[model samples]
Target: MTRLGRIIQRFQSDQGGAALVEVAITVPLVLLLSAGVFEFSNILNTRLLLSAGVEDAARYMARCSDSTWNNCVALGKNLAVNGAVTGGSARVTGWTTAEITVGKTSTAAVDGSGTQLYLSSTGTVDVVQVSTALPYSGVVFWDFLGFGTIDITASHQERVVGW
Candidate 1:
């Protein structure tokens, strides 16, 4: 055989199992990319849910009378957190009354008969902040590195004007 032929033969023999090595390295990379995709999507979904719930709570509270502050808070709390925000992390504050001046006359605004009433809703949730080693949900192959949970918070206010 020619000199080139001998060189090719040796290379082939030496690299017999290189494909396996390549695959071993590539597989982990692929899996890591996929896990990142999943975690990011989860975060997006969580954000969407939070936004919708905040809007819903604000709407409900705006419809209630000023006297129904406590009940309105309860209603808002229900809509804002789907058990996602544990303990006292989630909150619903009544800003309309707080905004009303102490000696301010019952103008058309505070008359409560206005076309709209202001409502407020705020929420917080634990999110994976750091996922360098563990997975978002805590799995090895699926580990996002337990990036650590962050408090996802949302706040909004709206008005219900119709009589």
Candidate 2:
């Protein structure tokens, strides 16, 4: 064979750079996948925290007494944001009471199939709902991904049990 042919054949048969080439091609993909998993978990965790806070606030409001109802709404908002009725550190970063909403709704005590579920004399149940929307702040800038401001929204409802 000619010199050029021999060189080309040897180069084709060489395995020295094969693993390096494969690693270089796969490293970025693996890193991207790992980062995605981490970000998803982080977002999920924040959502859970927000849900828990809303649930706690709803539960508190549901059992609140009529005399204290005026202050109960503010306390519920504080609980939803600070994880305490008296206010403290927030469960999620950048969360605030302004982002939380406390609402009262009267819903019929019936199942989805329209079957009466409660035997209450009033035939209607009062529900206290707490909801909040918190913008996700993660390691990656969501704006750069062309999705502006991912929000982690959570809400909870509880039947009013006045004391």
Candidate 3:
């Protein structure tokens, strides 16, 4: 056999580089999957935190007294962004009170039979809603992956119960 043919045969039969080839092919895939899991978890955690903060603010505003109603809205916005009535660090990075919206709504409740269930004489229930749309800034570069400007939106509503 020719020398080049013998060399080619030996190279083709060699298993020494097979493991390296497999690792090279799989390493990036494994890393990408791991990074995806981490990113998803991070997003989920941020969503949960935002939801909790919104719920807390809504509950606070719902139970606020009529006399303190003026301060309730501001405090509720603070709570939704900072997780505290007073100004403090935000629950999520880059979150701010500017992103939060606090509002009161008058909604009618109905049972499964479609009959109105009104507790107040006005036939409408007062609801406090807290909401925010926060832009997600991930640990990795999401924009590079074509996931442009992901926003995490959360909202919560609680029935008004004044003291």
Tens digit of per-residue lDDT, candidate 2, span 34-148: 8778877988999999999999999999998747776999888888888888948888888888999889988888878989866677868898889999987577734445676
Total backbone collisions, model 1: 17
Backbone clashes in each candidate structure, one number apiece?
Answer: 17, 0, 0
The candidate with the higher lDDT, 2 or 3, is 2
Predictions in order: lDDT:
0.45, 0.86, 0.83
Q: State the lDDT of candidate 3 residue by residue for 49-162, as single tens digits.
A: 999999998998888764777688888878777878886787888887789888887887765687876566665688888898989867674655778778999998888887
Candidate scoring better on lDDT of 1 and 2: 2
Off by over 4 Å in 2: 1-7, 111-114, 117-119, 141-144
Top candidate when judged by TM-score against the true structure: 3
* lDDT for model 1: 0.45
Output the TM-score of candidate 2.
Answer: 0.85
Model 3, runs deviating above 4 Å:
66-68, 111-122
RMSD (Cα, Å) of model 1: 12.3
**Distance from true location, Cα of 95 in model 3, Å:** 0.5
